[model samples]
Target: MPRTKPGVGKGVLHPGAGVGKFEVRRFHPDPDLAPFVEHLWTVRWDLGDAPPFVQRTLPDPAVHIVFERDRSEIVGVVRGRFERVLVGAGRVFSAKLHPGGLAWLGAEDASRLTNRRVAVDALFAGVDVAAREAAILGAASEEAMAVELQAFLRSVAPRASAEAARA
Candidate 1:
């Protein structure tokens, strides 16, 4: 089900702007990916002729990989609050990795990536960034995007140590 309750610092853009203008949906990860992933989330917006909406949020410990029409990046745990302006119509597909899941991606110190945005190819050597991005953005629905993302993640599943696994 979609996240109805407003998360920390969310859903306050232009208070009482009327419903149905924005939607945030979350989906469970495939069973095999549950160990390293929390879930996938998609944010869709259509502000129509209204002014742009500025959404803000406090950072969490989990790492996130955000995919958009023009770019995709592996966003490490942010150290401070950040804001994004939602203008026009667009959708963002994000994968929220579990706490300590960065280790699975070969990051020994997740803190090092804090406040940093790394290109996907910089981490996943064999991934075809363009193709993957196309598959994700071209998906007809959030569910379809989740399936594509899950498949891609499985194909590049990382190896984590026993200690990391326990963490």
Candidate 2:
């Protein structure tokens, strides 16, 4: 089964190609992530540049591009991560970057997600996934040694309930 919701109108990765794999463009400020962004700027500056900048900044690691099939447009985006600070006796420690998972949703779906009401709902579904992974890995809660990871997700929800409903 697909990881995303059911009833999503058959999303095409590349509009002209007409089937199979969608193109994903990775965006990054440094040489590490987005090479295309750099190439574009070499020619000249355009207001069109903003999307790449936004894409480069998102917290999600898996994200590369936002494909709008109808219009055949692609935007760069990163998933957003939720940081949990694991604190202990009289000290601040252990920051873990948890992939919120909801970051993968396209712009239209994600913009609606900002509502706190929706966020809390998704958290209930996704938290267990994170907790279980942490427990399995034996990332024991402790008072020292802070660890911080930066990444992103579509949302914290267990499933794409809202996106599903819309479809």
Candidate 3:
């Protein structure tokens, strides 16, 4: 067998056992996924805004993927985007703006997260993707992580009004 690098940032939480207890799938059939995606979109539009990054070629576009782990187990979901900057001739261009997009997929649903290591891994894998993209593009994450958190807060802001009205 060929020698491999150690802890090369494969998102493997565990090393020898091929850590990454979860797997991220493009789109798998799941009864809960629609609702999850709905909750994310309705209560969290930022989460679903990943693909547009690829569409506009925004140098950094958020991408969405349903996460599955344990072969068939449905783990929690997350979003990741990457931004890059092209530095040349004393001028810097924002190649990608938002890496590690907002992640509020199903926090309210404990069935999806907490104790489910696979779910959490999937989410972090999304994070890894963003990070790797930055590394590959020779760009820096800059403040993508911070921006993602802020977006999450903004997304939930609408819920407050709805809750107040109900009361």
Regions of candidate 2 where Cα sits further than 4 Å from its true position: 1-108, 115-130, 133-167
Q: In angstroms, how far off is 88's CA in candidate 1?
A: 1.2
What is the TM-score of each predicted model, taking all chains together? 0.80, 0.19, 0.19
Output the worst ten-in-a-row residue range by lDDT, candidate 1.
Answer: 1-10
| Error at 71, model 2, angstroms | 39
Q: After superposition, how far is residue 143 of candidate 1 from its true place, in Å?
A: 0.9
- Candidate 1's C-alpha runs over 4 A off are 1-19, 160-167
Pairs that collide in candidate 1 are none
Model 1, 4-95: lDDT tens per residue? 22341243344354346677777888656678888888888999888987776677777887888767878998888777888889888888
Off by over 4 Å in 3: 1-112, 118-140, 156-167
State which candidate has the highest lDDT: 1
- Consecutive 10-residue window with the lowest summed lDDT within model 3: 89-98
lDDT of 3 by residue, 1-167 (tens): 11112222322233343222211111111222222221111000122222221111111122232211112122222223222221211111111111222233322343333223243235333344333323322323223322332233234333433432453
At residue 94, candidate 2 shows an lDDT of 13
Compared with the true structure, all predictions reach lDDT values of 0.73, 0.23, 0.25
Q: Of models 1 and 3, which has the larger TM-score? A: 1
The local lDDT score (0 to 100) that residue 43 gets in candidate 2 is: 8
